[model samples]
Target: MSKSQQHDHSPLHIFLIFLRMGLTSFGGPIAHLAYFRAEFVDGRKWLSERSYADLMALCQFLPGPASSQVGIALGLSRGGYAGALAAWAGFTLPSALVLILFARGLSSLGESVSAGALQGLKVVAVAVVAQAVWSMARTLCPDAPRITLMLLTTAGALLLPGMWTQIGLIAIAGVIGARLLTPVQAINHAPLNVPITRRTGVLWLMLFFTLLVGLPILTHLLPWTTLALVDAFYRAGSLVFGGGHVVLPLLQAEVVPTGWVDNQVFVAGYGAAQAMPGPLFTFAAFLGASLQGHPSGFIGGLICLLAIFAPAFLLVFGALPFWSAVQGNRRMQAALSGINACVAGLLLAALYQPVWTSAIFGLKDVALALLAFTALMYWKLSPWLVVVASAFIGWLVL
Candidate 1:
């Protein structure tokens, strides 16, 4: 087949590729994107370069986490619904398990250094997110109208930091974009060609979600430690947006506020998560470990882990067969438009106040961030390196 005509969108293959991504992908979103390009574009030739770029743009245009969304998009291109689940599981599992492991080690550490490390980690998170905005803007926000929406959303988010408010703006932006920009004809529209008949489609979707919902319940009912693990992961997986960092507060809300974990321990685990290379949801691991003294012990850890990751899995699977349908639907598209615009706003708001102000603690942090940005944008060093260097620099200066 011609390079443009290379059309192997196999579900099993996608699962395997993402399994590799789960195992190896790290360095946050930029690093994850680079890994994705390596796997899908250079290694497999699954998508033409232009098509891959277009797909990346589309993912950025949506809500939720960009890397996760991109991974799902890739799987959808490969094997329709099944491919999406495989991709999510593959990319998420390694990091999730790693975080859990890290959590076990964290409980014994003192609170002070852990808190400092976490604060630094937040800087890394903010910087990386800003990097995403810059990269996406260069491509996704190119047009006059889109740029307008991007800036506008940023302004709105600055004034209002609430998640839903930010989400609303993206939906509006999508509407304006659809009206203004031409429909981006995807190069590989293979997954959109799902042959799921109506009855089969409904049946499959129902069964898929049922399994997703039932698995956690069944796991919960079990007296095994696995039940708690499953529960924790499921909750975290199900709701986190903008990747694992966003779940910081969610974990706090679910566990801390409920007295599942205390403040000192919570802060310490959050810090260690920053020191790690995997996803932020790894905080769940820390939470699980700390729960050792609780009634559930291992079960609690297991539950936290499972609850944390379940949402993402559920969303990915539920939307698998509906990828094309969601992409094409007017109302869903409208809501997504607002959500995307809100995400942009959220990023912008994040860029200014907490992300920038908190990190730019006087001249030193600013210097580090500028240096980091330069290394990323101009020197083109790997993002993980930037993060590590930034942490060391921060530690040294501190």
Candidate 2:
């Protein structure tokens, strides 16, 4: 069928299509991208391969979760603004809800079972993040220059150990990339059919920045916990450069220091999130629901979930109209290359700090993490299965 003839332009149809994928898609961001390609580009003939690649590139260039942004862009292409939202909701809500429930039920578990399971989750997180670092290093830090950038970023982050430090490193890396690095080969793709006008795009971009800057100021002035929650989550969502995994360090810095969520709980939720089948950004929902104080339960989860994802919504809509103009710019690509390498380094730092130190207590934990990593990297076992097995082992043996 022709593209137009096969396409279902209704927002509801878009939601339903993504909802199914939300429930079934696993592996992680890269795997999610593959699933999107199969279902949208090939199975449904929603768009051509080139268009899909174009959308993926645009999403990669932006800050928020790339897979979710790509889904939003795909929805926008077919169903307009509402479709974009529908796509995000469909792809995000299943996991968000599941994580929220996990957060709520965690407290009710038997003490020993909870401790064991949580430790298992934490151990698996170490394996998952280690795998991410290994995989991203292979892809993002391919050459000596980028490898140096990655190593330097890791060192700086480990030494400085704060959110601002990570952001500063990313900015510096971008500048270095633009000045020192050459752009990689580019693939030409068809123009995206974004329905948003430049004028609308500008307004969306403005809102994105407005929230980024204003939320912190508002939280500081008002002393509202909810607003603070929004600010922290929003900034994490906005500043994230690489992918969902990169958000780990940002979020730990945000919630852990403030005493909003315990460090152990944070790492445990992150591990549990790995078992869920959707954008890892739903990890925000888990954090929100697990908040220590007011607005915590379902409301907290909803607020944090929306706050973190708001930037993704705004950026994809805002950047779409302008993407065609800048897509071919070598300098822009170079800067992004540096930023990605730094992000990988940031994740490496995170793996050591909260994911590793918090989880690995002894030889048993080390064995479990190594086993999980081997399962992921060599055996190619499904991540969810590894997570489950790890949790069971923790309960039984740890």
Candidate 3:
């Protein structure tokens, strides 16, 4: 897979392609997958059909943003570590830059326009998140235990919005998965050792965790502004489970409370993020561009990018090394199973609280939400088109 010697693509061309994907790739993980399949698997022939599918599966199995991970992997295939970085840049740069520009515009817009836009944006968020819940439920909730877990996860998230609470749920599921989902070989082996790659990934996890905990504490005493922000995003990117919407909850915890971005503004940025293409992680671009102290904008976007994706890259490079050997392990499978079930719950929970409750404020709103959902589910419309129609409808309804 080495690209150092002979390759059809130069590093720059590969980088540019990813950048375009970042700039224009929208729709949630599934949509992102379709886009990737079209461009890389069908159009570019950058990845063979089988290889592309394998990469998508690997990303789906891991935590963090799956689509971003896929694009990064595609980048790595092109030129190793450098290629990966290039891909990250390509995928994120457009959104980051565009968001920054948007933030600047928002800063200047009169209150009347801003207020109306913000209100409309929140409604859009509600609709978008609702769609996520319904789509994921079908894909992830095939069994009863999983369906129950999804329900529980949603309830727990609503009842307790604490950071540790979220992490605790994910951890608890991991244990259940280990027991219930252990593979046949792992069962036969009796006890399996952690692969060196997983160990490397764990080390990165711990190292990053240390920075996350320590940097903020250190910054109060010293002058390490960037480190704290970097650590925040690095941690956010690394630890988050479901992509896009999941990160929204985490980012809300880290930033909004601190007055980083006002609640409505964040919602608006999210509304705007959906309008673009690429991974939903580009919402990080908006946070970076708009945050006070200006860190949330350009500089903040960089931190968010690294924070959100760094762990993913490490895990991909690290664990994927051992994934081939461990794929059939029931325990590994179980863990993913449990995690995925919870993931379904997480989305469902999200769908109810912020999405359904807040978005469906009135009868008209509910009708619109249902209409949009039906279009997506049955008519199989493009998300972008739905979003555009929804935005106008939101404006009209308001």
Candidate 4:
């Protein structure tokens, strides 16, 4: 490993770096991943491209906000427990704070302002995710079989349209890739300098499962609204796959149907979240603060925020050690290849349905999307720059 890889990053430094990203990583989860790649992989050389891709595959396999999980994992690799916490705080706090304020002031903000900016944000999402699908496809699905797998996964996700289908598709793709795809060999084969030991990882894994199994029962016995919030958000976090966008329906089902939040308010918050520069899971914070009774405000936001993200942190720590253990296993590597390809497909599917369908209503929207894409791909402007331009241009035009 180079000295750069071995150098210890201060927790404060990690927090600051991620805070900058949190403030500027606009679009959505897919776009956030692209920004992470640019900052961590390309700019900082914090990890190899292959390792970054492998870590993303792991995040995709497990449930939670994929981009947020990736940020947490990166922090862990860089600065241990404090780094992970700092990363989550820095990347999440900005959006959570904004959304909570939005929740508190929903009556004043109104729909018109949010609607136009949201349209702009959605257009930016289309461009950012398009770039991601293209880049990831080249990296993860270069071969015919992998390309076929990508296409099939995209089709399945579009045709079926649910979290379960997305999970099953990824699982099936893993199985198929293990059997059929070329075994992936690590490029540099460097062990990630993750801070936790195998024993600690095992303990974390046990705690994760314990909570997964016990939280619901605890909620049932307690019968408190806060506990209910915990149970609802925890279940949504544990089950969602693909990325932040997919979390929408799951969260909507959990909170909206329960009368915890109005459907219109839930939807408006979702739109605003797309425009913000952080993890989509932070929407939980908005919902929590927006709740009709008890624990509303900062306290409620804190509860929902932690509940929703706990599983992702647990799974990352638990899985990292085992990931190191399985590095040499050809079948495991092959499965990851398949999983990565399918992840590309998932992004592609998301681009079409919610992103493309919602954002592209006419030639004007189409023109804006193309302009944003050009700014990113050809002009090679910073994504934040592109996002800002798209938002302002959209505000004026739309």
The regions of model 4 sitting more than 4 angstroms off are 1-8, 110-116, 184-186, 189-192, 216-228, 242-275
Per-residue lDDT over 1-398 for candidate 4, one digit per residue giving the tens place of the 0 to 100 score: 67554444878889988898898777667678877876776568888766777787777778888899999999998999999998999999998998999999854554556566667877887888887778778777878988998999999999999878877988898899888888756466565667888899999989988988898899988999988898888878888776777778888888888888999999888877766779988999999998988888889989999999999999999999888788668888888788888888987898898778878999989999999888877887877777778888878887
**Which candidate leads in TM-score?**
4
TM-scores, each model vs. reference? 0.66, 0.64, 0.58, 0.86
Candidate 3 lDDT (Cα, 0 to 1): 0.64
Q: Highest lDDT: which candidate?
A: 4
Tens digits of per-residue lDDT for model 3, 116-208? 333444454455555555544555556677677778887898899654566677767767867765322211222112234566656755665
lDDT of each: 0.58, 0.80, 0.64, 0.83
Clash pairs for candidate 2? none
Query: Residue 302, candidate 1: how far off, in angstroms?
Result: 4.2
What are the RMSD figures for all models against the true structure?
Answer: 6.1, 7.0, 7.7, 3.3
Give the CA lDDT, 0 to 100, for residue 300 in model 3: 71
How do the candidates rank by TM-score, highest first? Answer: 4, 1, 2, 3
lDDT of 2 by residue, 1-398 (tens): 57654457878888998888787665567557655765665457677554565566567667888889999999888888888999999999998998898889764432334567667877877787787677667766779998999999999998998656866887898799899998655344346678988999999999999999998889989999999999999999999876788899999998999999999999888877876778999999999999999889899999999999999999988999887666557787787677778877876787888668878999999999999899878887656567778888988888
**Candidate 1: which stretches are off by over 4 Å?**
1-127, 184-267, 292-303, 325-346
Deviation (Å) of 266 in candidate 1: 4.1
Clashes of each: 48, 0, 22, 0
